[model samples]
Target: MHNDLPIRKIIHVDMDAFYASVEQLDYPDLKGKPIAVGGSGARGVISAASYEARKFGVKSAMSGRLAEKLCPNLIFVKHRFERYKEISNKIRKIFLDYTDLVEPLSLDEAYLDVTKNKIGLPSATLIAQKIRDRIFSEVGLTASAGISINKFVAKIASDYNKPNGQKTVNPEDVLQFLEELDIRKFYGVGKVTAEKMYQKGIFSGKDLKSKSIEYLEDNFGKSGKQYYYIVRGIHNSEVRPNRIRKSLAAERTFSENLSSEIFMLDKLNQIAEEVSNRLNKSKVSGKTITLKIKYSDFTLQTRSKTLPFFINDKSIILENAKELLYQDSLKNSVRLLGISLSNLNTDKKLSEEPIDKEKKSVSVQLKFEF
Candidate 1:
């Protein structure tokens, strides 16, 4: 199966602690100190942690309270996504200078197909080096690059030498590199899957590779074939250069549960404003609005409505959120409320079009007690 496919030179470039690094770059005082890019509130979660913070067992998606306990000196900084996006654009331009086959996974990571580059360079290693160098010189940030024969291996290789380093896996070495990798370290194999694999005595890539496709399918179902080929270094997923945003959302968990309708409305209004600001920043809108509620008992429920037209306005969002909130009485006291917009319209021109000042100025004000 591996010999049947062409050897495409793929490179995955990932920014080193992207958000936290950007914060440190902008604020010199944060340099050499442990910091996290996220909220510091009781229910807050860490979005990204600096390498210094990671030494203390801090990590992204960990609860902020736990991160604080892990690293007592950790400084929590609010996320500046717009600023990160600005730096990301600078890095992306550098990738385009080499090849148009760039697929961005997020603001700080992308997969580049340099099999046929603009500069006609033969070595993917050299191309990756130049890109990393340019990012440092031009954007004032460090990036790690992984060069391999395909996207799956390239993505994994990028993590091999992290924080201002690069690794290249030649076609012949692909299988060897994969076989030596830990099953837990493989992309897409989460804790649950890894535990299941461990129970089956599959601890590393070599163990996984030894299993028959029929056995993997019988155990893991549909994703079995995916693991079967990926372990053999046979991934053929092409770089999708035109990926679009699917949704925009904002959510907040209260330190104290709220049962009052007025209190819920006020929180909804704030969440709506955040969603509106992010939507306007990204120049996107959606027709579907989803309201998420999490009760104090940890039970969750979601309600959704699809509007006739796309909207990115706070007033519209808040009004719809209010309707969803009132649609049903409280089964239990809610500890969290969230609003999300989906079915996005990514057309730039539509977002850029002028809106009537009078209509856009309409704001929702909720009078409620804390």
Candidate 2:
């Protein structure tokens, strides 16, 4: 633990294969079966897969054709978003009972700051267990939790013991825990970044910590500074209760690729209508309209036009999208199309200050319990 950092108890709760688990819970026949929640068409992408399906390498974002080849008996189910939201709300209510400082990452995961909880329990580990138990008893779903001094470590720890288990990293063990962690397992290090780190011989946290801040910044830009600090257990980001929506979008993958501009007009209109409906429901409009095109070869392209004023009407969105669609020649047949709005009316100015920007006078507690 750093002497100038603040120590706070953070718990990250992530549900186990939420959508697939929900499906199994609602239908007894689906339980213990290899199930995937998504369309089972030629162009369909799996949204979620059950643990049984995962054993056969069936995973979210995989194509239905490939999943079928991997698991012969894979069952595809449609999404029930409203039901998922209802159950998520119930789980959120349980979190609120313990602490108001809860930051939801998604319907299936959240980060809770329980340094001073409503129940007056000093142990965050116990609170996490009780919350998980309550969720299983009340909502009929299992959740995993990770308890630590900050959000960064807690988020990673939650995955250690998954599918109805929890892990707590005490403050004193934070450094060693991070040092022994794989670089690929670090939250922000994706496949490309991990390969880059591997090229530089930075395979673990200890290896990442061996680099100079100057070297990291020069090589990895802004993210390098974050890596340098997080590896040292100095992440000070607070759990935000009200996370703002950054953008609104609607997209669809077609059963067959559209080769001509004339064939895309109808699909564009439908997508625009969906985006407009979502915007109206959120009661917000945006100045930036973007068109996303995914070709049959899987390459993606985006075109944007920022308007002088915000608009959320389907006709206006379709108009801008059409112009952007014709802005460039198509390299290949289009398989997917999308419309998105950003620079929204709901957006507000927020701070981007780094944790080490200013020094703290009080030393953080090194012996803080999870």
Candidate 3:
């Protein structure tokens, strides 16, 4: 089945420690120093760390205090989104010169399909080399590139030689390359899933391939089929350019866990307001409201409720979110609260009526307690 699919030339480009590197590039004194880009306060989290800091086990998402403890000399630089966006725009322009089939995963990474390009380039490897060289020469920044037949493999390959490197996986070598790969490295397989697979004696793609689709489905639900095919090097998902926004979400981790229901409700209201603002800014609404709860122990749970009509109002979203929150009993003190909207009414073909009908606001009373 994998042999029948059309081969593509996908390249995944990722910047090397983007934020920290930018800071080091602009400030000569910070070069080769252990620096982190984010707040230095107790409650602050590290957004990015220089490769030097990474050597000391300091990484993004770790608390500033932890980072400081890990690397005592670590310098924390405040995030400069404007400068990062400026550089990102420059990088994006470089990609646009090659192909229109560019999917930006973030400001620092993107997937480009160069199977057919404006420059009429046939070799994705050569294009990747040129792109990396251009970035260094023009932007004073280094990037890594991964070339493969699909986005998943390409993305993983980009990490093979980090900082400033490239890796290519040919079509004929896809199976062998994937077979030797660790299950933990497979996209979408998180820590919990990997641990589960490990317990089931599936540690690598080779082991995963040995399992039948039925066995995988029976254990992993809908993701089972995905694993079964992907292990055999069969990923057909395309690199969609100009991808549409599907959902909007807002979440916050508290400085301390909250046990009181009143405090939880207040936090939920704040999250709902943020979600509503984002939805309004995007000119979109959704019928599904989900409440995400992260316990003090780090266990996570999400409850969702689908409404009949799309809504962008804070009050309406909060009302539905509250209902979902209470649908399941609280298991532990929550350390994080989040609200999100999905099943977006973005399709013009099936959303004309709902858009008009939901234009007006509908208020719902908020009275609840644990």
RMSD in angstroms, all models? 13.3, 2.6, 11.5
lDDT assessment of candidate 3? 0.85
Q: Name model 1 segments beyond 4 Å from true.
A: 244-250, 258-370
Candidate 3, residues 1-370, lDDT tens digits: the string is: 2223556789999999999999999998999999999948866778999999999999997878889988999999999999999999999999999999999989999999998889987789999999999999999999999998878889989999998999998876777888899999998999999999999999998899898888999999999977877776666677877666777899988888898767788888899899999999999999988888888766879888888999999999888888887787789998788998988987433211121211111111211110
Looking at model 2, residue 28 earns an lDDT score of: 86
For each candidate in the order shown, give its overall lDDT on alpha carbons: 0.87, 0.91, 0.85
lDDT tens readout by residue for model 1, 91-123: 999999999999999999999999889998888
Q: Rank the candidates by TM-score, best first.
A: 2, 3, 1
lDDT of 2 by residue, 1-370 (tens): 2465678899999999999999999998999999999949899999999999999999998889999999999999999999999999999999999999999999999999999999999999999999999999998999999999889999999999998999999887888898999999999999989999999999999999899888899989999988888888878788889978879999989989999999999999999999999999999999999999999988889999999999999999999999999999999999999999999998976533456633321234556556
**Which segments of candidate 2 are over 4 A away from where they belong?**
305-309, 349-354, 357-366
As a whole number from 0 to 100, the lDDT of residue 77 in candidate 3 is 95
**Comparing 1 and 2 on TM-score, the stronger one:** 2
Model 1 TM-score relative to the real fold: 0.76
Collision count of model 1: 0
For model 3, the run of ten residues with the poorest summed lDDT: 361-370
